[model samples]
Target: MSKVSETTLEIDLRALEHNFRYLKSKLGAETKLLAVVKAFAYGSDMVSVSKKLEGLGVDYFAVAYVKEGVLLRDAGIRTPILVLHPQAVNFDTLIERFLEPSLYSPRILKEFLKVAEAKNQKKYPVHIKFNTGLNRLGFWENDVDWILKHLNGTNAIKIKSIFSHLAASEDENEKDFSLKQIKSFKKSSSELAEKIGYQPIRHMLNTSGILNYTEAQFEMVRSGIGLYGYANDAQIDSELKPVASLKSIISQIHKIEPNESVGYNRAYKSDGYRVIATLPLGHADGIGRHYGGGNTMVLLNGKLVPIIGNVCMDMIMIDVTGADCKEGDEVIIFGGNHSAEDFANSAQTISYEILTAISQRVTRKIKE
Candidate 1:
């Protein structure tokens, strides 16, 4: 790979394939895989990532919104996409594009049924999301009967899958809670299936659940961060390669004297003479202001340098003192040897936040 001359997000398709295969190795032969390509494929180019995954034989795709699914469909993605959250207003457009919706509540279910019936559709595929412990979305375990009653007379839609989200699958301390959630999902989904007289595909495992709760993988699994090469666990991280590398070049160098300040509001003061290098990327580029004040470190010519002062909208100043580096030298924000997880850890955040926070304006280059 060549060094980036400007701010760029380099995506490694090989790394993506490797991560996908690694995750698949943990699942059963009959189990299906759903790649979550929402949030611009976690801030990497969504279209490019989805195209690669499609070629790699991903079983399904998931997006958080109907528009995201529409974008994939517009890109000619033929794989079935599950819209994790769908509004009634977009139901017509969603159906037109052949995107499946996750009807998590009675209102959403009724609204979708009305749209489907009005559109003269029969047996349109839809998913039912149950609230096991994630309290964020989905129907309650007891809502199964209500759901059955609503579906009793309608052939406009069919339950393609019954699914739920894991709240703390990555935390070992919450193992008991995750297990209980799994048990509840199983009981609820099973009862619903028996009453409906057909077994809909049952899936509740996300990336972490794929690693921590393999026995409860049900029929399918969803992987987002894992496919981007993060498992939220150190041991699993070693086995997966990160697909995106955020890189930039030093734009300029500054010399600071004792008591002199750097950046806005004099957030960082030099106690002694120091050399600072300004990189052309900041909050506008997705490196938030919280990363300032030496909280985050970047690799400058292979040396870890602390980001000083407040992060500006379009640039950040890093203390590059004593480092054998010059202007135009490549700076690694997070990638390759220095993982995004490590970078996020320095700022007391997670890889998901930093990865998804990346702005779309940054140029994306795919490494085949």
Candidate 2:
């Protein structure tokens, strides 16, 4: 193991196991589970996370890019990996890597089918993504017939699954809209399955949908955040052990007399005789400018300290007056009293953004 840096992201693998077990309990014995490991497994060491999931007998893994899936496979992750957004250019590499692709459009489907046939890839798994509600990637209901017709004579690839995304599964306000999307996704999947002469593993629920709409989890569910020890309910953050704890040591501490300013732009003035601790992390490392000027707090000695002005690219200063912390003491940016949602709320964003926004430079430690 490398020496622990002054700043590091600690990932609790046991907490991941607990979250997986909890999620497994929520689904019936018949329900299949596909763990989504896209975005470097949400910026927390994909190889470690995916290996643990594979050992736990997870049914499959899904990544955002074909290259991401290939990395997992190269790392000896034997679980079936679904590449959610396979571009046409990487289709050959995807096939060479034995990675499954989510064909989002008819053009992609036709191109992938041709490649599969050239390689004599018989019964290779492929999923069809429907744009039921997300309006992002996926085929429309009207294009289903066109999709099936385009591949009328191809035995190169098999329809392994059909899935859709829930746009607002976590919000109760959009129940009607959510239900409509669910209904539409089911209808489209069933129609295509009939045309293909076999039932594809029909899945349409993301992490939020899996929590709220149990009935819509057809044959499988793709979950990301829930696997990382977070729930849609922000109030329950305390119960869910956060998998990533970003901690930095107080690189230095300074005693500021009254009327003294701190950081660039002198955003915060010392009101009285006070102590300030500088963290060796900043916006360039994903803390961002929005967290500047007392918008957020960092934890010191298990107590909260408001971050003073202008988060620089390499460091941030925190007011630690009246605290028992000293130079080289550990400070938490999030993952203790401050959860991902808590930070996001302060920054006027969502948990997903914060979780995936961590810079790659921060060393990640996988806790055994």
Candidate 3:
């Protein structure tokens, strides 16, 4: 409950829990949930976010790299972690930490096997990524035989689960494509399971997939943005709470006259008299330069305050004309009465980018 500093990212734990429950409610008890905690839990603090979800009995946790998993493990998270896009260099660390990698190719699978065999490890869990549609990562459907040839009857890495990503699960225009992805994943998974002589957990649902492709939900589902209170769909978005509230104090207030320029590069020139309030957060803190010179606005006392000039490395200037508040008044970049979507819209970006862009320097205060 106390503020960390002049600027802070207020993470509402209650809202986080609410959002988790809301997403889980959409699925059945049979569906396993893997809470995606990558990118510092969307730049809100993975240690806190993962611990909260772990406390709520989440089935698993996922990260984009081995170090991210190690961070959670070091923080006392005991749940299984699937490294989404693990690199070859971190294989040893991943193995030592028992971090599962999403094996996407024959080469990756072979490399991991060599590491696992040399380490004398057995039955280590590894997820096979199939390129059903998202083509970004994953072994192609035809590579199944090559996968089995390398792993069959070998005392190397064990296949734990198989998954594929949905490219446009949130877009109605891509319904056929999503269905095709599901069908492909299913066929590929079943074929691999038969060849491997057993079934590993099969999952294909990402956040949007869980919402739009319920039938495609296999043995488990990976919910990322939905758990952080975003669904990419207006109907589902209304169901989840906005968990991150970016708030900062108006460190100073100044009165500017006509034709007066503001901030770096002197990009903004006042047409007339205006009140400028400086926020303690800036692009170096994850706001980015795109939000400068009337591109975005911060909310103060329920009124819109347009951002002015080139955003600085440590701060931003907002035209807070006629606002009741002064220096030290609370300024909301996103959250509270103003929504993250609106803030992101003004910046011409998505909620995901805005929420995850907050730099590590911004103190995160967990709201009970």
Distance from true location, Cα of 19 in model 3, Å: 1.0
Q: Give the higher-lDDT candidate: 1 or 2.
A: 1
Can you give the TM-score per candidate against the true fold? 0.99, 0.96, 0.97
Candidate 1 lDDT, 1-368, residue by residue in tens: 57999999999999999999999999999999999999999999899999999999999999999999989999999999999999999999999999999999889999999999999999999999999988999999889889988888889999999999999999999999999999999999999999999999998999999999999988899999999999999999999999999999999998889999999999999999999999999999999998999978899887999999999999999999999999999999999889999899998999999999999999999998
Q: Which candidate leads the pack in lDDT?
A: 1
Cα displacement (Å) at residue 310, model 3: 1.0
Per-residue error at 302 for model 3, in Å? 1.5
Q: What is candidate 3's lDDT per residue for 1-368, written digit by digit as tens?
A: 45334788988889899988988897877989989999999978899999999999999898999999999989999999999999989999999888999998878888888988889887888999999877788899899998988887776678889998889999999999989988898889999999888889988898998888888778899988888788888888788888888888888899999999898778999899988888898898988889887978788878888888988999998988888987888888888557787788887799889988899989888877
Error of 1 at 119 (Å): 0.4
Worst 10 residues of 2 by lDDT: 233-242
RMSD per candidate (Å) reads 0.7, 1.9, 1.3
| lDDT score, candidate 1 | 0.95
TM-score of 3: 0.97
| Candidate models: Cα lDDT each | 0.95, 0.86, 0.88
